[model samples]
Target: MFSRFVAWAKRNLPTRESMEANRWLRPVAHRVLEPSLWRFTRRSVPRGVALGMVTGILCPVAQVPLSAIFALPVRANIPVAALTTFITNPFTTPPLWVAAYWIGSRILHFGEGMGVEADAARGWMEWLFSEAGPSLVVGLTLITLVFAVVGYGASALGWRWWIVRKWRARAEARAA
Candidate 1:
């Protein structure tokens, strides 16, 4: 199921060859269109996910370009990195921000009552200024780091599992 999704996504993404034809991308084509950055190796995909998570969660607006920047240097799967930016869309950002503010307040000792007061306040900007602003920044940073780590670890584990599964299948076939 996931593999099918990945395949479809890969297909939908503009190929390196095509993207290079763009006047904007032409000058930097050598770096952006690096072959290793586009391949779907076990290592690249997870690193791409991590890079994407970092830029997507932290930058929000420039996630795609930021991911592309990081992916090029790290030789991560560029398409996967570009695609993973949607993790923080319009529907999901509000809740994540609220949760981050809450966690940040707790960590920074603004206390639960302050958090409640901030929440009940009229405007987000006002509530942010009262006490939660710094905490919110801290919380957002922490959350981005956590998500990036988790994404990278999960991909690594998945890659390892895939290798093991393939080995077992090959052994079974040979035995038969």
Candidate 2:
């Protein structure tokens, strides 16, 4: 099972020029990542990593689309946007949608305090059309606004920090 998984991962996540680059890059990656791995043992690093993962997993609608936006400004650190993709992992997607629906309901002041079930949220648009056609517009608008605010803010901060660090490193390297 492990070998199969490794094979699949290698096939899907191939690094181009692996033979040439790995000779040098592998050692450098290991050296750099060693400290990062050790730093992950600290509480703050784990918290930051968790926040990044949650932001990626919980804000799928915003994260995926805005990853492109982050990619534009921080072209050198595309990996940050790529890492943000973890927010929409297979396990967290359903719950995220349900939460979005619940948030939408709250913002619209409809179904007050009623926890949104996945099935109910999935059919919410249809229900709105039948039961409260006018309210559907309000619900959709509220959902968009809430998601945009949360997603944009989190992704912007993450991307901004990533870009700043990269720029700082380049500047320091030039100075050296």
Best by TM-score: 1
- Top lDDT prediction, candidate number: 1
Cα error, residue 149 of model 1, in Å, equals 0.8
What lDDT tens digits, residue by residue, belong to model 2 across residues 100-144? 566555555765555768437657666766435444445444544
lDDT of each: 0.86, 0.48
TM-score of 2: 0.35
User: Pairing residues by index, what is the TM-score of model 1?
Assistant: 0.86
Total clashing pairs for each candidate: 0, 3
Estimate TM-scores for all models. 0.86, 0.35
